[model samples]
Target chain A: MNSSASTKERILTAAEALFAQRGFEGASLRQLTAAAGVNLAAVNYHFGSKDHLVEQVFKRRLDQLNARRLGALKHIAGLQETTLEDVLSAFIRPALDLSHDGGGGLFMRVLARAFAEHDDSLRKFLSENYGHVMRQFTVEFARLLPGLSKEELYWRIDLVTGALTHAMSGFGIIQRKSDVSETSHREQTAEHLIRFAAAGLRAP
Target chain B: MNSSASTKERILTAAEALFAQRGFEGASLRQLTAAAGVNLAAVNYHFGSKDHLVEQVFKRRLDQLNARRLGALKHIAGLQETTLEDVLSAFIRPALDLSHDGGGGLFMRVLARAFAEHDDSLRKFLSENYGHVMRQFTVEFARLLPGLSKEELYWRIDLVTGALTHAMSGFGIIQRKSDVSETSHREQTAEHLIRFAAAGLRAP
Candidate 1:
């Protein structure tokens, strides 16, 4: 059991890097297994197939992301003192933490690729499995901002998520300064995102 | 000269679709050439090489996007009656038009992938070539939003672009309904995005 768990960990780690660099089709199973320091049979034994492996890669990170977000939301949900920034922080902080931490930095790139690819199956999987987290957040947002219509609220939330994904992808520009500690940088990032998002959501 | 131009056009069109679907490295020259209904020699002869062709694919659409943005900006630059929405319409309308239109629809996906890749050379190319356009927009946004500090202004602008890219990619959801004509839908999109972005930029 111990060996099997470690082997799965190794494959996932290597797959994230490879998928981030080479994309889904570009990173063949041979290269994936090789990068993981495993063989063809090992990958098959552990994950069944490459398709299954891709789903697992997303599941590993997304489960962490959504769980963190829901946990943060639950702590403050429906509270008398909850502000928009508080809920924004709940949504944004966990994502920012994921991208800056050592292992999951590249996971954002994977998510970005999935977004760009617009793969139908992947979209369905995400909605079916993880859509509830977003729905719960939307409910909280609506409750907080009682004035905005449903369509209007959804539009703002969509743009907010867009900004979140774009920032996490580490796109064309934007970076942390060398003078700051990682934790400090993340704190500032969270502040900036939540502030910007809160203002947008509350916009007339 | 006409034949040559059309050949180049074909290669670019094919390249954009392939790159959007297969990504940069995953789409081979052989496939690109075949899909274009041109010979391998045609690609090398026209674009110089595969890498150069990749740049050309981005350049073609980016040049159009920036030109439209600048043209719109020029019309209203320093005009007395311009509202924030007017300036934003100039900035965003062309992009929404690009995606809703047939051919350039895939270009957003390409842009998303390039952003995801975080490729140093491509990033440099973009900033060097098109940086002036963004700088001009920033100056205008700063003028309109005089209260925001330079650092704060830049941070807000960065997040705004992130959201813009995310929305354009059409990842999973948030699409136009069949009942809404594309033009009306785009108009609404522009309104939604500009309102949200204006508020974010003005965040306290």
Candidate 2:
């Protein structure tokens, strides 16, 4: 990568860790810059402002994560043979994979912090940029669970999303055994989440 | 109420709002005292320290919440006639009720912040004080869902806890309609959570 790209990458990486550790509001620009080994000017030059930097931090991961989810959903969304489990796996596996990725786990913590902190602008940024991903998945979920009213469907999806976010953020007790490979552990997590969510969504 | 008791109540109420708005670390003692309209010595006199104050904030709500939950669970737990929905309603209804209680809703947001922030001592405090509530519920859950392995049971329970926490914190999109009464809204919420959680727990 070019020097500029590398610097931005470094800032993003350090910012993710600090943000995960000390939240969006708690982590100041000076601390973030010092951690990144970049000066305040570099942060300003690259990301423009702390709020923008926060947005970039989310954008970098979510853009790719949502794309993978959308791609996976497209493969089975409306197909006759598509089971609820298939739809759930498409939605869940990518997030589990991201949680296992280097620094990606930290990002989940940051995302959880975002959920915890009711910063309206950050929320709007997230909804504006990534709302469509959730909307599309909801569409497929609606098609599958035709008996559910729109309100009921939204509630279940929200609950499922919460569960998935919680699990992926490592808030659960199911830590990977030392013997299990990352891939295997992630696969197990996806299986567990998909099974539980499918059943929850399919509730009468 | 006596002067001291009223003062303590004022501090707690203000603390809950500040903590919910700005997290535990972010909300300073000064801000807390100012918000409470009390002096620093008053906080020290009542709670001893900010950490203890934070604990008190949780205790104020969780004590009552857990007591109600355990009371609800006791009525149906281990009964042969107790369905999964019964157990789930036991676990969920109190939390839903809490979200509607005056200043109780803000406490849920504070609880979500607790989940987001990886502060070990606070977690230890919660787990030590309130862990039994979960353990008792798990016992009842295990008795009902004999098909699930111990590990599987924990996973589902964790997911259910996450969903409930997320929803109660008002993170989900399920706002009460203007036509709905507070009691009605809470009832509907409990129903949604109980149904979803019961189905998730009973998953193969």
Candidate 3:
């Protein structure tokens, strides 16, 4: 049982790295097994197939991430007026903090790649597995911004979610070119994203 | 020369489709050449390498799109106190219009896939090639929103760009499941995005 657990962990670790380095089609089972120092049979034994492996990698991080987002939203739900800042923090803080967690950075990159890649199977998996989490956030957001129409609320939430995902992915389109410290850049990004999102959320 | 022109076009069409479907690393030159209905030597003669082929596919559409954006921005610049609508139109209309143009839709899908893929070489190529276009938008945005600091502008633009890209890619997370027509959805998205972005841009 102990050996089996270690083997499963190894498969997951290698799968995440491969998925991040090369997308779904680019990362083959042979490469995955080799990287994990396991046999092909072991991959099938642990994860069934590449698709399952990809799904597992995402589920590992996203399940926790969504829980945090929902938890934060629940904490703020008691307020009579959900300030833009409160809405922004509940969504952004969990994501940003996740980036700093163990292997969370790599997972962020993988998630970014998944969205950007737009593979049909991956998209289906994401929609199926995490659609409820997203809907939960949407429900909270709707309550927070009660004045906006249902359609408007959905659109704002869509844009806000897209922005948050893009920022977390490390695209760094806004990163300064000079020899600035990485810590400073992270702080700047966090502050800027929150402020920018707040403006978007509160816009007339 | 006539043969060469047709060959180039064929290669691009094939590359765009394959790249969109299979991503950069996943799509092989062998498959590309075969799909293009050209011999291997023809591809080598025309584009030199897979990377060059990828670059050419992007450049074809991006050059035109950027030119249009610049033209719109220039027109807006000539007017004093550009309205939120003007700024939003200048930023988004070109992209939406491009989607309607011939072969432009494929390029959009490919561009989205490029971001989602894990090829560093391709990512670097895109950033180096089109980074200036984004910077140009940023400069104009900063001018329009004098209330926002440069950092704030970048952050907002970053989110705006992400949402726009997500929409362009047709992920459709905001779609209502109950008998909603696509045309209405498109109109709703465009309108909602503009309002959301304008609010964000105008946010202090």
Candidate 1 vs 2: which has more TM-score: 2
Point out where model 3 deviates above 4 Å. A29-41, A78-81, A174-191, B28-35, B39-41, B174-189
lDDT of 3 by residue, A6-25 (tens): 99888888888888777777
- Model 2 chain B: ten consecutive residues of lowest lDDT: B94-103
Clashes of each: 0, 0, 2
RMSD of each: 2.2, 1.9, 3.2
Assess each model's interface with DockQ, reporting 2 decimals per model: 0.66, 0.78, 0.60
- Angstrom error of the Cα, residue A113, model 1: value is 2.0
Note the residue pairs that clash in candidate 3. Answer: A116-B116, A117-B116
lDDT of 1 at A80: 69
Proportion of native contacts kept per candidate: 0.74, 0.75, 0.71
Q: Candidate 1 clashing pairs?
A: none
TM-score of chain B of each: 0.94, 0.93, 0.85
lDDT string for model 2 (A154-178, tens) is: 9999999899889999987788899
Whole-structure CA lDDT of model 2: 0.88
lDDT of 1 by residue, A59-84 (tens): 99999999999999989876769988
lDDT of 3 by residue, B1-204 (tens): 998899999999898888877778778889989999999888778988877888899988888888898899889989867876787888788887776567776666677777766578878888887888777777777776788767666777877887777777765566445687655655666677888888767766
Models sorted by lDDT, best on top: 2, 1, 3
CAPRI band for model 1: medium
